[model samples]
Target: MYFVYDIGGTFIKFALMENNGNIKMKDKFPTTAKSAEELVAQMVEKFLPYKKAVKGIAVSCPGVVDSEKGVIYQGGSLLFMHEKNLAEMLARECHVPVVLQNDAKSAALAELWLGVAKDVHSATILTLGSGVGGGIIMDGKLQSGYHLMAGEVSYMESDFDTEKLRGEFFGRTGSAVELIKRIATKKNLTDKKDGEQVFALIAHGDEEANAIFNDYIYGLAVQILNIQYLIDPEIIAIGGGISAQPIVVERLNEAVAQIKAANPFHAAKPNIVTCRFQNDANLYGALYNFFIQFADEVI
Candidate 1:
């Protein structure tokens, strides 16, 4: 079995799985460490529990990852990971072959290899969580772009002026956090609540909640429409924590219908679906990376 890790800003999700995408064990822990040393130590401890059975380590990291060099140029949320040779460092400590992949690209790889996009020629995944993350596949290949920033949809700017503020990119405008914040503010909730709580209010058909929810879904629809115009993929998959909610897919489709009806020039109706892997996409994708890297070897 190979160990795979999906390294995020606030948590590290790890799993042990075979090359066939069958997971044997999986768990996650908070990413409290801020520095490289602490981060390495944390990973080392996690690996210690499954050391003997693990043959290699594959990481799905959030950054401008140079998979060829096993280095991260710019860590998205973990600034300390910048300029770090993560695969090498972790390999030295864990004593295993290591490979690294950008988180978004990994998700796309997962879909192409064994998930929803497996039978499709080209597909894209737009992850709506704290921000808008994405992965694109074209002609059965992942498009990393010239700067290895092909799928960084979080940086995409909306047509509206709200995204002009510093750090207020499309991610801030079209994301679950934004939706929850809108609902919380509208409902005058004192304590901060998560997307689930806010969604519950929307389910109850609260007037203010419905308004906020509709606006949020509309914002996401705009982004999806923009994606269709640009990439024109065969299908687009919506992934992230919120996508697990059945209402999210229903609402997004409704918004898409509205947008399409409003525009006569837009003839393309890109097929959109919810991601199948959900939270475990990165993990399965990371294992796929490991599999491809060692294709000559039998596991």
Candidate 2:
């Protein structure tokens, strides 16, 4: 058995998995802890009962992770996670070996192992939610780049100098949160409107909402095109909470088509697809990563 965790800014999801990839038990709770130590204590308490049964713990978190060393160089939305070796921190408390994997990379590994990219040798996963995160696979292996920042697509510049002053990068411009926020602000809706509320307006034939939705999809498509031109992966899988909406992939494809028609000189476009595993991807991916990291031991 193995203990698996997918740590996010708002929540920390953990599960116990059997060797055959079946989840024995799983649960999650809101993340109220502020620092690494507090988070480690929470995990230790949750994982204590299974300490005698599990072989090790696997963690998937948001950051530029030093997978080999089990350290995080930078944390994305979780500001307090920077420069923390969470694996070591957790291991010391639980008295079990722990492996850390970047959340985006872990999700990509899950796709490669069991989801949409199963048959492909080269693929990329773009997780589009509050922020855009990415994972890349080339030659049937995860590519972490020299600095382990290879698939950090959130920082990609979408409009270049136009929004630099506003810190509006691809993550902000191509995210569901940004779309909803923009629509809410433009349409004079109540403050703190979410994606569901904004999309409801679009569904009801609100012109302003439709316009924002179209522009958001356009930005995502262009970013996908840029990713294609750079890596040219076999397929680009879009994941995250917003990707659950059935129309996202369809609308993005339409936008890609429009761009292709406008820029006839650019002959190549990416093959885009949606992830099969939505919210649970990180958990499964963390398990897959654990297996890969300890293949010899497990086998």
Candidate 3:
């Protein structure tokens, strides 16, 4: 058995997997702790019982990570700046081999291995939720550019207005979460638990909700166009909590159609599909990475 972990800013998801990619057990908990050491300690305490059965571990995290070095360069939203040798720490504590990857890259691997990108040689995955996260797969392999941050699509600028709105209209980081928060605040809507609620209101014909949704979709479409021009992937997969809403997908498609109509290109437009593995793609992809890295020892 091997262990897979998907560490996000708000939560950490874990799964124990067999050699054949079946999950034996899975669990999740809050990721916010005082420090990385505390978080690792907590994980060790929870996973110690199954240590003997596990062969290795794979981790997917949100940040600028040095995958080759097994150190986190920067924790974007997690606020973990100090260099932490994740693989070494885990290997010493659990006595097993460990592999690490960026969360977006892991999710793309999941899609390529078992989800929407299974048959495609090149693809891009966009996880649209708290933030717009992305991963690029080229020639059937994950692409981590010069510094292992190639598929970071959120930082791509659309227009001057977007740059201005990022902080004033959105928030400090100008993230998807900030955009949603701004929409909810402007609409005077309370109890906004997730992105789905915002979409639900839009579906109910809320004018302010509609306007916010339109702008969000337009910004996303601009990014998609940029990605399409850059990699020209065979397909683009959409993941994350917001992608669960059918209306969002419909609106996104509409925006894409508008773009295609505006600028006719010789290459066919790539098929945009929803991710098959929803929220668990990262965890499963982490397991896939572990298997790929330590296949010989696993069996």
Give the clashing pairs for model 1.
none
Q: Give a tens-digit lDDT track for model 3, residues 163-262.
A: 4573222112325566568778887768545566776778899898888778877777666666787789988888887667777668777888987787
Cα lDDT, model 1, residue 45 = 91
Candidate 1 lDDT by residue in tens digits, 92-113: 9999999999987888888878
User: What 10-residue stretch in candidate 3 is worst by lDDT?
Assistant: 166-175
Model 2, span 1-299: residue lDDT tens: 89999998889899998876688899998888888888888989999988999889999998899988899877876768899989889888888889999998998988987899889979999988788879999988889999899998888774446545544578778777777789999888887447777778877889988988998888888888888988999999999887887778988898899899998897767888999888989988888888888887543
Backbone collisions counted per model: 0, 0, 0
Q: Which residue pairs collide in model 3, if any?
A: none
Candidate 2 residue runs with Cα over 4 Å from true position = 162-167, 185-193, 297-299
Each candidate: what lDDT?
0.85, 0.86, 0.77
Q: What is the lDDT of residue 173 in candidate 3?
A: 33
Candidate RMSDs in Å, in order, are 2.3, 2.1, 3.1
Query: If both were scored by lDDT, which would come out higher, candidate 1 or candidate 2?
Result: 2
Tell how far residue 64 is off in model 3, in angstroms: 1.8
Q: List candidate 1 segments past 4 Å from native.
A: 160-168, 297-299
- Model 3 local distance difference test score: 0.77
